[model samples]
Target chain A: MQAAADLGAAAPSRRTEILDGLKITLPFMVGAAPFGVIFGALATSQPLHLSPFETMALSLFVFSGSAQFVAIALMAVATPAWVIWLVTFILNLRHTLYAATLVGYVRHLSLGWRFILSAGLTDETFAAMEDRYRRLGVHRNSHWAYLASIIGMHVNWNCWTMIGIAVGMQMKGLDGLGLEFAAIATFIGMVVQKLRTAGAQTAAAVAGILAALLAALPYKAGLTIATLVAIAVAVIFERHLERRGQA
Target chain B: MSVGIVILGMALINLVLRCPLFLVANHIRIPGIIEKALAHCPVAVLTAIIVPFALHLDQAPDGSQWLNPDLFATIAAVAASLLTRNLMATIAIGLGVAVSLRYLAVF
Candidate 1:
């Protein structure tokens, strides 16, 4: 009887955590919906000639918005497959940092659980998970919560992609709607929250400037280079400040 | 390359970068320098992506290009984000500003 009661008590909290995960992801889904739709529409249109199944599978498998968009654009121009792979890989290299940030929170889980969770990691999911980890730390059921958020976002993205494919078939031009700005706005909102420190502000400023200056670089390599340089500059700036404080 | 090859290759690349560290999180420790650098990663990366899009860097160089709708919309979005810090509001205002300016310029 006591074991039954304890199981009942544990079940509701896990349910609650999952529900909270959905709640936290609601805003990100709203932000991502238009971007996903744009990707689907673009993939199916014009010289790209991607079938609906292929488009859907891209969302289902590759699952990175920026990388998928870049790949589609490169394929349209008949860019070499190896170049597409290299650019997309560089675009997603940031995920390594995201995973590193999350390693501590998820290290206790089994290998299977880690694999499942890591598959769904993206900029939005990473942002959501980082906020949750920072505020609450890890709990017995935190991984469940993380999984729920990932699944919620995954479903949201795929659904929007389908909707976009449908809309693309019917309409002539969806990209002109300026709906992609939603993604820009969402990114700004997320980055603003993190720019409260001098080091963070310095990193953002330097990266932004360098990216614009290096915009002429082929295959979007400038973004990767700018990001690396900015991180180094910020770290050095912070260390100098620390030494000054000690003195 | 075939579409299947492209899809599988991209998926494999993404999975490799995202999954290996987590799979071996138990055995590895991120060095202090890399960890500290990672702390600033999000800010740098997102900013790098956002700036080019906001500036319309792909367009040919012209005086009028600098005054494009995306730049103003981005400025409005940044202000809205700083003031409200609400994602929905930021997007709405940014889109509102961008669409209005775009159609207005067309007329």
Candidate 2:
């Protein structure tokens, strides 16, 4: 993973890291392709009846699948505009955590670069970029690689979404494909891979159980509550370890 | 039309939520204790998302939907994920199991 050394200055190895980023992101791009298409299809389908331009515009600007999906579902039921906005906000709280976790890695970056990276941070991009950072065991300035991954997905999402819109206009349905389950399984795989520590492992279990219990909470806020509870428990355990000089 | 405006609102609020942390990342310094928690953020957030939805309790005709296709497939996915450690493979396995079960008319 660490082919280039001497990060001497920001973006010096930009070309190489961008290529590395693209290569690392290839596998995820394949997995996400169908998801983008499905989203586009849903957007243009009868229930939502969104114009292709609206679908593309949302894809271009919003760039979040879950939020868009939730928004579409809400809008299909004629949910209030405020509720749609609120739901999208709650669904996106996880990005705040992604931002916090990336602080140590991107603190040295310029504001302009940070803006670009932040806009691009999603579940898949964060996973790919974070995997690379952990491997390098260094903190900052992989934005070139990070940038590559985000930009690649951005382009891919837009393209497939447009294609999906066209397909939706022609075809009737896609629900039977069980595509959403694939997304679920992907997250499960990511969670398993990152559960390296006992504390983290137990924290994940706590979060999962609590989230399942509170899944009926209004506006999907249970996710935020569950995430916060897990973080609190994990931090408490980490403090114990730190006190014992084992951290 | 009005829908366009609502979506614009979405884009605006979204960018506002997304931009600040990265923009201020250089200025703000997080303390050590919080950093430890942040390290586990991915696992927590991801698990929060997956578990509740994967085990969704929507009712069914023949008793609990716990016996439903999604949950049954998630069980298979979890087992496959633990063994494969590969995201793509896990997705394929889970989707395959769920689709197959659905085709067989399993709840």
Candidate 3:
């Protein structure tokens, strides 16, 4: 009777673990949908005259919000292809940092999962998975859950791009009732969640102010430089605290 | 210059940024340097994104072409974020304020 009770309790926990991971991880798909809509709308306005298919494809292939924004903004002005490429590369250079952080966690996964997961890597996905891994050391199935979240985000974002393009095409002009507000709202929600900690709050504020001040740098390179500067400042402060052994 | 060159250059740069840490993790021991560097990544990246857009804003009441949407929205976003501690609410309010100000001809 005791053995049966233990087995019954253990059975539910295994199911609960997977369920909990998916619950938090799945919302990113909804959160990411607005960006896709914005992208599709913007892409249609570009000189390239991208069809919905093309716009969706770009979302799937690039999958980087900042990079896609930079690409389309450059394309709008008929900027040289090489220059556009360079700008996108610089904007996305930070992904390497994420890739490095994740390596320690995903090192034991099969090569196939590694490649697929690598392709789906994004800031949000990495942070979500990192927090989980840091909390409860890596587990074999955790990668699967992480991958599920990534794939979920990828599909929703791309498919929503199609939806946005369709809406953008049909609507003459959305006045007052702005569906576009969804993305902004979503971003705010996510940002609020991230700001619960003092360190996170401080880091976000410093970075934002620095970025604003450096907005005019050539090639929009100021943005990238501002990020580096803020990071340097944050790191210095963190080191000071570490010296005191605070964190 | 050429498409191939552009692709190659971008790919190489991406590779350089992404893979170095993994290749060397087992090799040499570093003391908190990587962690510190990683810590900066988000702040650096976000700042790079926001600063230009924020500074370009010039919101003034006169039709004298003052007030930038980007800058105003950012200010509102930040203020809302800090005050409410609610990202979604802050962003919505910020965007709303910016667009409203734009429509009403107010900075």
All DockQ scores:
0.49, 0.45, 0.31
Compute the lDDT of residue A48 as modeled in candidate 2.
Answer: 66
Worst 10 residues of 1 chain A by lDDT: A1-10
For B44-91, candidate 1 gives per-residue lDDT tens digits of 877887787777775532223556788889999999989998766887
Summarize candidate 3's per-residue lDDT along A85-131 as a digit string, tens digits: 65566456557667766777666655666766776777778777888
Candidate 2 global CA lDDT score: 0.74
* Candidate 2 chain A weakest lDDT stretch, 10 residues: A1-10
Report how far residue A82 has shifted in candidate 2, in Å.
Answer: 7.4
**TM-score ranking, high to low:** 1, 2, 3
DockQ of 3: 0.31
The TM-scores of all predictions, comma-separated, are 0.72, 0.67, 0.65
RMSD (Cα, Å) of candidate 3?
Answer: 7.1
lDDT string, candidate 1, A59-171, tens digits = 99999887787677557645567766766675677788888878888887788999999988998889998998888767667777899999999999999999988876765
* Native contacts retained, all candidates in order: 0.68, 0.62, 0.33
Chain A TM-score relative to the true structure, per candidate: 0.70, 0.68, 0.65
Q: Candidate 3 docking category?
A: acceptable
Q: Candidate 2 residues A1-247, lDDT tens each?
A: 1222344444446688789889999887887787788778767775667889999999999988767765665566455576567656655766776787676677676788888888888788989988888886443346788999999988988999999999878745655545456556656777788788877897798888887776666655666688778879888887787779863
